[model samples]
Target: MSSPIALHTIQYNTQDIDNDTLILLYKNLLKPRLIEEKMLVLLRQGKISKWFSGIGQEAISVGVTMAMNMDEYILPMHRNLGVFTTREIPLSRLFAQWQGKASGFTKGRDRSFHFGTQEFKIIGMISHLGPQLGVADGIALASNLKNKNQVTAVFSGEGGTSEGDFHEALNVASVWQLPVLFCIENNGYGLSTPTNEQYRCEHIADKGIGYGMESHIIDGNNILEVFTRVTAIADSMRQSPRPILLEFKTFRMRGHEEASGTKYIPQELMDTWASKDPVINFQTFLKDQGVLNESLEIAIKEDIISEINTHLKIAFDEDDIVPDKTNELNDVYKSFEYQEIEKKPETNQLRLIDAISDGLKQSMERHHDLVIMGQDIAEYGGAFKITEGFVKQFGKERVRNTPICESAIVEVAMGLSIAGMKSVVEMQFADFVSSGFNPIVNYLAKSHYRWGQQADVVIRMPCGAGVGAGPFHSQTNEAWFTKTPGLKVVYPAFPYDAKGLLATAINDPNPVLFFEHKGLYRSIRQEVPIDYYTLPFGKASVLRKGDDVTIISYGAAVHWALETLDNNLDIQADVIDLRTLQPLDTETIYTSVKKTGRAIILQEDSLFGGIGSDISALIMEHCFEYLDAPVKRVASLETPIPFLKQLEEQYLPKNTFESELKSLLEY
Candidate 1:
């Protein structure tokens, strides 16, 4: 093996700190190192499936955690065992989490440091790593909004800095001047890939300068330096709200995980890092300063070992979590029943856009903690002008404008929801949701099931074709979110349903994808009540009742079904408008299908894998015995929406619903 370059020592001053505080920091560092040693034994014995060793990087986690106030939030990555230990989370519960037992933070739903506890003010990172940066921005944003003077500290690896989310999150934090400490643990290797391969910048902190934020690089292996600098920087941030980037240079002493060997790393480099081991180096320093002696060090090690054995025994005695299909399915979403609106008021004729605006305004007035954000949503209103004049009424904080960053904003909404606030994210168009899909599906959707965290967010998606806006701006992609678990999908056809259902969506304790058909925003008008109201999800609205055949649809397709029935009075049919897709109104669908003895499902999305396919399968499975013919499906072509008016009209399912309804009625 080639000889490796020696690492430089970081200068630090600890004369100001008292002996007790310094000893406590040493204990915190030693605890995780010993616990990791025990876990390595468990991994070898096949008791634990995997282990991500933070053996040498303990100083970074311990120092940063000890420096921050207990109430301040921290979002940590996988290799942050010291963060949990320093925060005083029970070892028994943590062991149970590793053992996949019931008492764990996620109830055995997730593994590793992938779980979060609101009680400890720690939000765990998802596998993607980058989203947590945005989530930290959200927590800080909430703290800023409430004037709580709270600061958020978020951690990431040197490799994670390369992700787009890192840039988006840093840019947003810089623009808003949110109080967040962006800590990058530069551990030299990201799963065998070295730092040089990750980016061209001199240091990870350099990226922060591009975002117009103060940046710093510190020696992560030095415990005193880590603690002192982080404490001072965090204190400064609390009094004056702003984002700061901190790059801590450290080395990963072990492989990414135990299973992934260190063969990729040079033997000499590993040896070079071994000499500067944070835990050993700190112990030696403490002994030299007369703060710790050989006997005292031995006593602390013995105590930590005893504590680990006790917790491991408790975790071992716990019953294994056997999976139950029914229980697993039930836990996918939070149990929230339909709520009824209290009072009724006089009605006024309004367009779908106006009704949505009224609903948002009323929701904001009702819930003071509610925040709505989107590009051009505040001063310029929205693309559809749905939130026009909202900033004037609610102020810029509640009704804010966001940069063209869909992914980061979605995660920010999740973070806001995490901090006990309701948030609504508006995508300029439904097609734009693709950019924000990761956090929505992997994090926000699974938060409740995984860690009992409620992401009370409403994402407004302006959808549908026929407007000649082309594929990018115009698309009915409700099916995209409908297939994912833990999200409520709502698409209303008229002004009354739009207003009522939107109110309900805003109040839902889970993430909701509310699709507003841009094509119907101005084309349709109805008598909508000025007072706040709510409609139940998972309950389809029967727009028209007939017995010949059942025609079911949602969003713009519901209007097409009514139009078809209006034109063909002879073709009597039951038309059902599904308000929500995920919590589907299968009861209404089955009843209508059984009574009519036939069914025709319609959708604005393409035929294959669309929501109509699911509806058809359900009807055939439950109501097949009463069927007169096969369940028919009318939908747009399986192709991208066109920009030309003529092609868009042809691409829409409105022109085909009438023909399909007649065919089903005849059969």
Candidate 2:
């Protein structure tokens, strides 16, 4: 029900500048305008590319930064050349960033304005639109866990409010009541489509009404008004344990990026919006206050020009790229193999989900910096009830309940993980994870390679068939993540194994997706170890070792294999659990296949381009010498999972999906 966010109006004089002397209120507004104007000019001249300039949105950025303490976190997008500059990114270095120069960040290796200074508490900028809101919440949520007073401020454009991530981030923030400010730069157009045309809503600010958030829409050009309201909200948000939504009505003086020319924009409207430009309007306000004299104005202009030139010089001087730096691209997009319980001693006392849940709970206990947030995961204890009583144990501060925005949850978790905390984000259902694919594939998967960074995030998706939950509820899309590189996918069929793997994933330096089959939670129960035990990734397990043929699968398929074996009419199959699908246990799979001289892959997911396909490819590449009958597979039909029970049963892989095994046994 939430719509695009906007700002509310407020008025104040310089006295409301947080009772501080060094940082002036008008100066905060002045700084944003000065820097943003330079950035716009750069964009206009082709000196800058991908500029989301804050031309008319200066007040919001200035106000937010002013409201924030120096130690509080601020996550800004490309538009906030103003935001970053106000927080201490040297103007020259900031300008050098537009030139893609080394003197900026990583000697210019990072995307423009995408790098954050740890000292300034600017976690970083995310250009992938609404995703940063989650990241900001992550920082705020972490601060809460650490029992710190720091609040994180996240800024985005009105265009981004339409994105799922924006809503996702906002919902989570509201539920957790984290000390964060969600500001929307509501500049009428999301690349020429009016906000009204693309969306239906009274106001983006009003959108926060449903989720326990305090919402406001400000005249974005009003600097004094912005600073006063933001200062009060940022100061009070921590006490209420809630987030605030401020929509700043502004307009872009230039195109979306550097090249779009605003061809779709009507000139009259453009001129009218421009007439309320933040920089010009604020300057007039300063003049009225006797603060804008010729000497002071000249000084500010000269300072900006000098800073830009300095940055340009640094950029040109060190703009050289390493010959092989770009070559590292391939590894950045690769995924790892899913492994089972490693060399750790095997015990007969554990089930998979129990193991995973224990691991999640234990890891969170060990690392106070780790946060586990999901829908109804706190008091309701998760749909599978994995986190039962965690709200009482961990408190609602650490165990969060979020609105259903799976994609934004993943993004926020990733951003928080990247900013120095471990995050476990849960999807109530595995089938719902598709909502998060945009940031997961385009950003999280490549961030380490792109930024030489690592974000530790665990996504627990309750997946699979057989729960009678129908099409939308039952899905095993681990392979979708399997296909994407830089993601570690784990599908643990047993409880104990699940706990250990979940723990390892929590501690690992990269992103890990842990899928729990909702159908398996109660079906396979065992008493897991009371103490901590870890399972290494990329290690497969031989469930029932056999020599006739190898049956490889994970999650419910492993259970199906056991049932199929119990009803045996086929060859003795060596069933292996691909515990972690990515970073696959090739040696175990290949060795088993080689010894058996036959292999039958089984999975509940569709047949085409799945983890099974990857397993086949690996077997073909390594164990071809051991093949007896063109590596057979038993899987579901390549079609949508049906709503009708009969059709769903017909479409899914069942225990009877043993044609390959039966034929081999007959032979």
Worst 10 residues of 1 by lDDT: 1-10
Candidate 1 on 394-473: residue-level lDDT in tens?
99999989989999999999999989999999999989999999999999999999998999999999998878999899
Model 2 global lDDT (CA atoms, 0 to 1): 0.74
Cα lDDT listed for each candidate: 0.90, 0.74
lDDT by residue (32-143, candidate 2, tens digit) is: 5655655666666776666655566666777778778888878887777667867767765666666665456534456666776676777565667777888787777777
Model 2 has a clash total of 45
Q: What is the Å distance of residue 204 in model 2 from its true position?
A: 3.8
Query: Which is the leading candidate under TM-score?
Result: 1
Q: Estimate each model's TM-score.
A: 0.98, 0.84
lDDT of 2 at 97: 60
- Pairs in clash, predicted candidate 1: none
